[model samples]
Target: MKLSLNSFVVVALFAQFASARDTQIPLEWDKKVTWTEKYGPQSDQPFSGLLSFSHLPYTRCLENEATKFDIAVLGMPFDTGVSYRPGARFGPFAIRSGSRRQRATNGYTMSWGNSPFNQGVKILDCGDVPISPFDNALAVDQIEVAYSTLLDRPSAEGMGERDITRLISKDGIEHPRIVTLGGDHTIVWPILRSLHKVYGPISVIHFDAHLDTWEPKTRYPGQTTDQSRVTHGTFFYLAKEEGLISNQSIHAGIRCKLEGLADIENDESVGFQLVTADDIDDLGIPEIVRRIRQRVGDTPVYLSLDIDVIDPGLAPATGTPEPGGWTTRELKRILRGLVGLNFVGADIVEVAPAYDSADITGIAAADFVHDFLSLFLAEKPPSVGPPAYREEL
Candidate 1:
């Protein structure tokens, strides 16, 4: 039986519409988000009840309670530590606001091979840590104090018999990863300090343009001691000297030393396996992952991503924008490469939301955060409960 061309055309149109609806539909996996109306009274508003930011209740851990999050996403808005760019303190909120709008999509392309789907990853935005408006010195102190509470050891201060039992039983068990949004690149120092206190000797995957190894104690003249104390430009030197991280496991991305390669090679205390922008072009991203994995293996890795690692053409909202940086596609590929690694903590830093047009930098930064979380979640057990972000549903 020959079907008419008009009948065939009608059938094709129906199928196309159905496919579009399916693609646009939000995934129903996030079962914890409870959305509500804000501002107006319950009667006057379109919806009742105030919106709760937390997706999960406080059933375990003291650190979780103080931040009002099972997994807190705090922002460190400190850029006074930077030598080049000054207005990165506003990075955290912009990144969060931009990421809050993206739904699940197959962001992976065929060039990266068959990348697996992200499983149940529970991430929450815990908001930004307070900073001093007038004083740069006070801002660093404030961030340290705020982060210290989150990194505090478990306590017997307010625990019942049941709570004590749970604590003892779950001792040595790592829970609720912290995804910190940054004000400046230096904000990662306190976070790494916290993570090192709990999960010691973490391997750092430093993605940036500069080596950031300048210290007051170094031979470089005119570098002051006060400047080396807790600034954004010199965290690597501090981390090495203070023994927060091992130099052997540090991998730097998109580097260019104007003074020559002597600085990086001479520093025995900070041995960076360099992945220059040209290295990405010559060897490709798969090789980039292979090298990163070789050095850091399956250890508890901390990913410190600077948005300035992207070209100014792509990401203009950073303090110091490099000329040849990773493309969005390449950056995503690198992230997908680290999916199975044991990542305890991570941060997406140096996104100055105020500098971009239509918040494009914020959008890119947020998307990177989303991709990182996706990779992190891909490692979780398959049978666990759904993700904790269901407000979109």
Candidate 2:
């Protein structure tokens, strides 16, 4: 490889971080978020309820969930696929709880200079996929079918719909964009398979400390069954077999240990370019962004972020906690750089909050979700591109 990856850290550097502000709901929020007594209370206030992510609740049948919304956040609670720690099934819940403090009134972010909430994009927290705990095969089917159903739905408004590569649907209206909360990394296989039916093969921006493209035949040699071959460690291998990947897929913050150099060769064979975690320190955010943006070109992109991509020291609730990883801020800044990519779907996985200290890991994941919303709603900055965004649904 031209770029030397030092000891090849996937360390995106998510070590111990600033503890959250006093988590108690502030009384002053009532005045800012709630309606005065003369008028009724603001029914949309987010801090005090079991509603949804960021108090943005829109619970309905899956059909209704996608029809009116431009973007929806769905959760897949399956973690039976993990090779190690197994509490990521609770990731969606923890991320939502972490976002309790984010209300529309205070949703403005300094980076993008706008509030993602109430930005004319209908966003909903579409709850979790009721995956079967006992049956891994059945759970896989459930995730694929569930994601496909929503992707087929048309929204009331179109944000960036492009039919040049793949048709959004019949009549060519925009299909809603989905921001998923994941069960584990294995869930990405079915998502890519499902997306393949709509967008054809997709380029992926994978953020992880490990290169998860292990060949199951070698990694799990004793297991020969169809389902046995696809653990979180080997699902990308499965995706590769299914012809679901584009050559442009790239992995950032990849610092996981491997058996030998052949693993990197194998990873490249699976259609991924690597930018090790230490590369962030050497090249900085802008160059990393430029590399990713140039690599994917105009392909429909799917972003899959493994929470372990950040230094496990900071965000330790993931299945495989590698020591060095990206810091929460650096990762978010890099994500912001992806403002104009043709993003079709995205997910944050392996955030097992049960192991968290002060909920920092979950809070960081929720903040990434917030960044995603702004990315979906906001237009690309003029300085960034000539190949613009397509509002499909």
**Count of residue pairs whose backbone atoms collide, per candidate:** 0, 27
**lDDT, each prediction:** 0.62, 0.81
Model 2 is weakest, by summed lDDT over 10 consecutive residues, at 384-393
lDDT of 2 by residue, 167-225 (tens): 53223446777898978888999999888887888899999998899999887788989
| 1-393 per-residue lDDT for model 1 (tens digits) | 999999999999999988888798544456553334222432212122221112121122323464333244667777777767677888876775565444334434243232222232333455567777566667766766666565452332322221211232224633456667888877766676776766676778888876666554453456565644666667777777777776556554656555655666644456466778888878877677778877887566788888888887889999888888888877876776665566766788888877787878888887777666555555332222122211111
Q: Residue 364 in model 1: shift from native, Å?
A: 0.5
Off by over 4 Å in 2: 1-39, 42-47, 63-67, 160-171, 382-393
TM of each candidate vs. truth: 0.71, 0.84
Candidate whose lDDT is highest? 2
Error of 2 at 278 (Å): 0.7
